[model samples]
Target: MPNPKIFDLTPPDLSDYIAYPILIVSHDAGGASVLAAWVERHLDVGQCDFLLEGPALRYFSGLKIEDSQRHSRTSLVPSEVSRFACVITSTSGEDVSLEREYIQQCRLLAVKVLSMLDHWVNYVPRFCIDGRLCWPDLLMVNDVYAQQLLVAIPGAPPSLLFDNYYLQQQVAQVLQYRKSSALESTQILSRRILYVSEPSTDSRYNEFELLERFLNSIFNYDYFNTQQLQVRVRLHPREKLGKYDELMFHTFSEYSINYCKNELYHSLAWSNTVVGAQTTPMVIALYAGIEVYSCLPEVVEKMTLPFDKIRRIY
Candidate 1:
């Protein structure tokens, strides 16, 4: 159970609006991670039913929920949604329209809907589907930064602050890993960097191009030997395999490059430095006390990440 006093701004009690047998929906990994952490911390496992798709299914798989169901984009029907008192969904960047569809259905049925925002960018576009806005009754955010962003939007739904239990849990894991390894200092002779990759949505440069620029800039530095520098590219859950293979082969062929196959904590533990363009893992790496860098190359867009510790290498 979550301690209510932890937050300076207390959100309304779930019991006030949410009834038993609540439905939780998420399609992307980022939203799924937030919703899953909230569920583990706040909700009773017996009273929640999860409707998950894509990477969300993987995130919720470890939960001991008996009523969880995995569905394709179109398989879940509107009739099934009427059974729940309220619907909770995570805003997704993917092209899937199921979340908007659910919000539409919930609106017609007069059931309350709560939507959670996982990232800072794309505040309004996430709820817009097919030129129609499917605004929820209430919006939830984990940080003041996200809440401020939501509140700035004209006629945006009421936003509430909640603890980012997912990030908190990850930070704890990273700290424990550090303590167990007894790693007081990073190895100076060899440098291990984990490049966390995300699909380029709003960036002027594509993911591959940005990565290429990052590699080129770092390689030009005269201090480190090429053999001693290792890079492991960790792909986003939405990204497909072999997405960066061509770039790895042709552009950064001389460097030691490989895909990260380990879990997130293990991968972070293996590296002294982490790089990405406004991805959540980079924030996690920053919290873990790893040297973090943002690789935005010639992009005119302002950096969305609110952390000052993340050095902009571009």
Candidate 2:
């Protein structure tokens, strides 16, 4: 671990001495969102090349890239990448190997690689490929808590604290939506709950199991039975469309159960309460002044979200 570098309001000037175009790469949804926000806020779209796959392709859509294509780790040519000024990537999940492979290849080619981490968990494991730690030249995180976590890890790469422009934008969008919408008063009067689901990558519980527990807990409360409660579950981008079909069949009779059909802000605006384990959408909901709850089971060691405003339901 080294002393963390903190950047000010603006992103680092990557194009200062660059002679070639910058290459941006991402795979997972979380990382893709962060990288897409960074590129939109800081970089010149025309001068960058993008190699987006998975959910990243969706996030980076509508951007004007010099060359944007999906390529696997094996298809990434050394000679082609060596021509770039540098590589900027997002740290993806363990299952994804493209970012780690890019880091190794970039290192071998002496190309400066900067990797941005999207979430707070799995700091060390993100860079571990084939039992070897593939440290980038610099790792970027959004906040002080993430910076501290990375610094605590043994042999962690140097990290930079950059502003989370994505979250800021989301907050702004929520505020703008609330001001323009006429149904804000009525929405607050109703008991609309939104459960944002995430893949249980670091937890012992899966989405279905946790959601069942949540449903059971709410059902026991007498107030929920009397009130007109509307419940909707928003699945993670990685989750399949019909992943919660079985759960819906069993719980539909108890309450008006449905899947979240709208976008993030739209869903938040319609809900007065949002629940999740440690997903990022819950954070957005909190920023929008919605009631948030952590529904992690008792079997889990502890809650990972660092926000004190989020109350624990279990």
Off by over 4 Å in 1: 1-13, 67-75, 182-186, 221-227
Please give the CA lDDT of all the candidate structures.
0.80, 0.79
224 Cα displacement, candidate 1 (Å): 7.3
Tens digit of per-residue lDDT, candidate 2, span 1-314: 22345423354454432344778878898888888998888777777777778999888885665444444455665446787888899978898887888888888888888898888888777888899888888888888778778667877766676788888888788777876886477875668999999888754777778888888777656434546678898988888877888777665565688898777887887788899999899888888898999988878756667788998887
After best superposition, candidate 2 residue 46: deviation in angstroms?
A: 1.4
**Worst 10 contiguous positions by lDDT, candidate 1:** 1-10
Evaluated at residue 225, the lDDT of candidate 1 is 51
- Could you give me the TM-score of model 2 versus the true structure? 0.89
